[model samples]
Target chain A: MNNDILVTQEIGSFRKPQYLSSVFRKTSGPELSRLKEKATLETLELFNRAGLDNIGVAGEMYRWEMYEHVAASLEGIEFFGPVRSFDNRYYRKGSVVSEIKRKNSFHDDELTFIMNNAARKIKLPITGPYTMADWSFNEHYKDKRELALAFADILNEEIRHLYGIWSKSKSEVFEVQIDEPAATTHPSEMDLVVESVNRSIEGIHGCEFSIHVCYSTDYRMLFEKGSELKLHGYNLEFANRDTNELGTGSEHRKAFAELKDYWDIDNTKFIGIGVTDVHVDYIEPIQLIEDRIRYAIDAIQDPAMIRVNPDCGLRTRSRDVGYAKLKNMVDAVKQIRKEY
Target chain B: MVKIRSIEYGLYPRSEHVRLSISKWERNALDHKSLGKLMDAEKKEILKLFNKSGINFYTDPLINWQDILRMVASLSLDTPFEKISRYRETNTFYRQPLVESYPRLGEIREEESTPDSHLPGSMYVSDNSDHYMYFLPGIESFVSMSFLSPELNRERVMDSFLEIYLDLIKKHGMKRILLFEPYPDSHFYEGNWDIFGSAQVFYVRYGLTEGSFSERKDSGPFSLIASNEKEFDVAARHSEVPGIALMNSQNTYLENPEKLRKSATKMSSSLKLDEIFVTHTEYFDFLPHVIANKKVEILGKVGD
Candidate 1:
């Protein structure tokens, strides 16, 4: 696959540490590093089974969403937020440097210290710029779309900087993925979303681009408009039964495929089907994964056109369940590929 | 603990006179199904229906009609609402429209937030029970209120509608008048209209200390806010009974109707508003329930 397609573990382990604000505990660094290393090991093993040569493992966290409040409460300070919300679920603070520095510091000192030795691609997960902007109170712009585009402009610069780091690290592959749970809520924003994405990804060539849309119900609402947005592929829920949480079932899969078909899946785009169920404790057998994969491929009417992943970020489930689910999914997909 | 043992009895009518008035005439504008067996097939039974109604303060004469159009239809740019074109159908409603959606705007959404959003002029309940009107079985926190602008009447046709209404009330004993929510496009909604009104439109604003609300303080977002903002952060609080009134005129609200009766020895209070009205209607079957609520009192005969 050359360096064009960086394989997982073929690179190095991913880093994720519980970040603390400015205060350092005596054993904090070591404790963080140990956890990160364990997570990296689990990730590599799962990706290896899933047949991902250069896979990266990461987590989703709620601590960030309630950041200002969390920060205030933890520090015993009353806080509305660092960023006030126009609606909610977003903040309007922190510069790119500060954000990256904070993230990298936690990943490196606390998480990376142990995680670094493990071999895998260390990917940085960011809440997509549009979602970050959308979930926050907007101003200095007339239209919401304009605000989103402006946010995207700043984000594009941020991604370029991260990619520069990947280049200097001497790593064969470095990746960045945008978590876009809010994309589906304001489907009316879709008219200009594709153009905004192009602006964000402009000039950042050679790095794989991934956009994940979550809180799956948004899928049902803005599906027709969202399918047309420009992105390497989309990651969505396909099997959650909980009504509160987004669920993607056979019907939803078919609906997505239908919209994608309307968008004309002409080799230029790829669709990622989440194969692992993020909810519930029971493990799905490899055969069921195989069946779901078959269903997705059939529904899309194209095998090469699909990419497989978990229903959502693994941060939600316990570390063991997350690890097992990922391993099971990858294994099943590998078997399905062999049969094909 | 303060032993606040206060005597409680039903409040008597402030007026000593037994007020008796009936709607003069009733007519509907909308197309309605037949009231075939409901009206007189043999010998002018409607007159008999009226004769039989022993209308009193609590007894209302059933003047089935479309009141707003009779009053303000000419003001509307759209087609003026015509009569129901049918049915003197007997309808009885237990729920008051005024207090429908209590503690939350104190009114229902006019069957579905469209048809009734304004207040008409003075309208009183009829007490005769020979025939019944509709008894809406929902919440009744509102006393239907409406206001209309004069900008309408591209042809200035409203002048003629007022004539029809005044004549109807005088002749058919029209105790109530229906009014359209005066703000343009407030009365009708096909959905996606930028100009529809809020829950405030359904309520009548009554301030006792009022020079007028605009002339005083404490009137927040509910009073002078722009319609464009589509916001009313400040809820309206009026001590007057009907939290919000509805199109039906038979209802009124008194926060403590029971408390008004403490002077019963001097005033000889007893009759619930129901006690003052007609002899028929099933309201008596639920009499115990009403009395229990402290909403009504059975004062002995007025002058006995």
Candidate 2:
């Protein structure tokens, strides 16, 4: 392993194998567990082949959808019919009818399985409190901020439980990435996001915390108020809005210009820069991915402060395309590592 | 006694059948004409529900529209939208428009706007001589969803679109227009209310909190949409306007029809208003077709 290279990690989710996804909801008990394990094992092998420094829960196979997964395991939420997120993909949204309490440990099985089987380092991605509050219909709590704080308390407990399980075997810091796709949508609620996110990771030591916010129109607020968040890094999407041109110039890499804004606010936190777009099947050339990373490295001027990944989850793409995208991203990092 | 009226505006969700057809059409399994037929059927079914509910005005279900902003952007001649962004705070997404210059309006075909023409237009026609209501994104909302160039004049761009929309309303015989403005606190439309002159315009503001109610003055006749009773109370206390929309269209959980009717009656009686419109606070597009259908029935019952 090249220690000098920037850490390359899978952000949140990957396309599950047909054998697992086809029967994910239909079967339960040992049958579903067997299939999820099989799929996770396969995905771990694929990540290993892609030369990933960190595999995110081996493609998050143990859970179905992020919102539905957490909401289903909670006491107060009631599942309504499915609604479209984008394209044809739909997830069953829930309404918080009462005070939310954890009905079950959300990521225990996945994390336990990864610890036993995986060789590389692992990062567990949990849906953040702000996103949980934003996505659900709020029928409870005094307001969205209060509901978010309630969720933050629940998440703080869940993370502590997961950390207990991970600490038994591992001496190194356990990684936790809070997935908050709705983080920057409401610019006025940045304070709520900061407060709730800080509360989620409150007093949870020995765990490196990060936030994954994908496809936002404006990330300035997140960066501006980022110093207040108790997170170690931010994973954000850029390639979806960026040009594919292979250049490090200001005009060539228009989307990466936000790195300057981020650097202006705080330069200490790492950025898991998304180099490939997950919404399309077109495989970004290695040079294009290299230009994206090169632009970030030039702006930040630190290899350790930069991480490379896809714009968002690769669940939207087919397995082959996702694997190819990751492979190219890793290869780009490798080519750039030789310079250091 | 205060006169009670019911109406609905904003995009209604597509049924499973229509949603499936669209998915298939995207994959090349179904043809465009076939998909159009499916959507047309969906629109007709929604229209039937509206007529049976005895709504005083008819609005397009907009089942085929991707979102409010995207539909509005489609009317632009420059193809301003480039990237998909989240629609406000909702899980649904739309292409964010980037307006570099003053946007010129594309030609509006008579078939596209006239009540006697195609699917959405046809949706506006009723058996009786009922008024037609059209839903549009307000000026602030349009600016919020887009990236305006530094050189572009905001008021000029807003005025241009507003003028075209007014012309369309007059030409197509649309009696009412509801501008969907979710964020009133932004104050993006502070000095631009006069352009709506003489048009029966109602600004629809949803996702409001108690703090937001007192933040802005009532520029014109507008309606406040509340998702719950507490919000309804807040709106009641703040609104000196004639009408209010009080229901949550963003969720799938069915509201208690009896409770909703009672609440509407009590609010109307207490407020001593001349008119009350019982409808969803936001776009019904956030819901499933079956649930939205049920809510429409409840809306009719409340108004009755």
Candidate 3:
């Protein structure tokens, strides 16, 4: 698999093994760590077999839901009952009670483990400050902007710590994907998203940062205002809104039309184009995956600026389906690279 | 002091029993009849709580509804709904109906056949009992959530839908209806407000005026939800509506009854209206059932 032409990466999360998922919240201390490590290794092996160039945190096995994971780690945040995100899937939302402070490191252990064990490059996916603020109840801060900036400070510290861990092991530039699923949900809050996201990676140097936003109704706000963000790339979901028909034309690939809008405003950043729908189990055929990537390549006009990934996270799909989807995605990229 | 009244409208949270039963039914482990029985029991319990709490005018818990728009669309509209879209900015999602063309009022009548035929039986209160509010999506909200065909005129569709809803209300003997418009801001079309002025309808707006709470002149039969003290102050001064729901129902934190009562009393004193309705803001579906129950009890105390 050639990484130069187009890199195939696991964007955010993969479905955890049954053993770990069954007792994820029940077990703790050494037992929990053992199970998480075992699951992470297994997931890494799966990504390796699927021919992925960059495995993101080995499917984020060390965490549960993105917002809750970070919220649970911080001070002055109390989790409420589970709320439905989509379908039957639920995540417990948290409220900021007082001043939020970092109580513990969110991804140090996972990054340390991945850096030591994984043979491939790793991209650490952290829930961005804008998302954390948006998903939470803002009782403490004067406004959501203030709360998001507060989270940005906490994230900056956590990212600095993670960067320290990664730099010690390898001199290669570490990749940090700030996952902000709520980035474009509020049209008026584009400036806040930009400010908070930029604040998150403010002082960190020698890191290739990207933002992963999934299922946005209108990405025009993000595309128009995305130039202000201090990010090197954008990993966004398009397959969820696109059709499965095999064609590279604009009508057939209507969702990727936004890629042109994005490139028109700013073409400097690499875009991780989501080639497969992760919500459903229908594994996109290698040919269909190729068309999506080709459509994106045509829009961006540079194969090097495109990265191939699933729409969002594979956690919603089973391991078998997730593996098959990624396998097809990798195969699609391999086929497209030959043309280059 | 202005007379205080307590009421609630919107989807309540499902109990663990109901939620689990739904999951089981989806997996084919439980039958539809069995699931219905469980949801009925939960609804009864919620009704009993409302009665005991002295909340006279109440809404059905809507325990069985997936969202505010889905049930109404399925029961009323002839247009086929397609994909599940995110409901407002909340984590919950609903099946968005695709409006291919301007729906005719006659089409709604044909779809319903009879007024009672289209109404969800569980949503209706007993004939002998006191009136209960019915929750429906506002025309603007429905249009916003729907997938309108590019060729269709949006204003015509909205007007037709409004007529259809008004007709339904008249035939079904729905006394009070809460039109949910959960926009993050308070800006609503002035034209729609003129139409709603003629009906016994209250525009329930959540996430009102994010940073600065602008005084909305002649809000007209609306209930503004104030989650915090800052919003409460803004809503108290600016809201010309007869009622204002206090405390965020989406949050699970059990608000102190004493603090809530103090805030309610303060708010009541400032409003010029003779009486005001105090209730929880947003739907209880965002919270767990147990937490929601406690919040209900707390609301009772605050209104006292």
Which candidate has the highest DockQ of all? Answer: 2
| lDDT, residue B128, model 3 | 31
**Model 1: per-residue lDDT, tens digit, B195-273?**
1122111122222122222222232112111111111112122211111111111111212322322322222122111
lDDT of 2 by residue, A1-340 (tens): 4555589999989999989888988999999999999999999999999999899888989989888899999999986577877545678778888999999899899999999998888999999999999888877777899999999999999999999999999998999999999998888899999999999999999999999998887888899888899999999999998977778898999999999999998877899998999977889999999999999989888888998889988998889999999999999999998887
Best of the two (1, 3) by DockQ = 3
| Chain A alone, TM-score per model | 0.66, 0.98, 0.98
Tens-digit lDDT string for candidate 1 (A117-195): 4364555555565665444433235655775676576567667766665676545545556666566555566655555
Q: What docking tier does model 2 reach? A: acceptable
Estimate, for each residue in A192-256, the C-alpha lDDT of model 3 and write its tens digit.
Answer: 99999999999899999999998888887887886788899999999987888999999899989
Candidate 1: residue A220 lDDT (0-100): 44
The 0-to-1 C-alpha lDDT of every candidate, in the order given, reads 0.35, 0.77, 0.77
Q: Give TM per candidate.
A: 0.43, 0.82, 0.84
Candidate 1 docks with a DockQ of 0.02
**Alpha-carbon RMSD of each model:** 23.0, 5.5, 5.5
Reference-based lDDT, residue B289, model 1: 21
Cα deviation at A48, candidate 2, in Å, is 2.8
> Candidate 2, TM-score vs. the true structure?
0.82
Residue pairs in clash, model 3: none
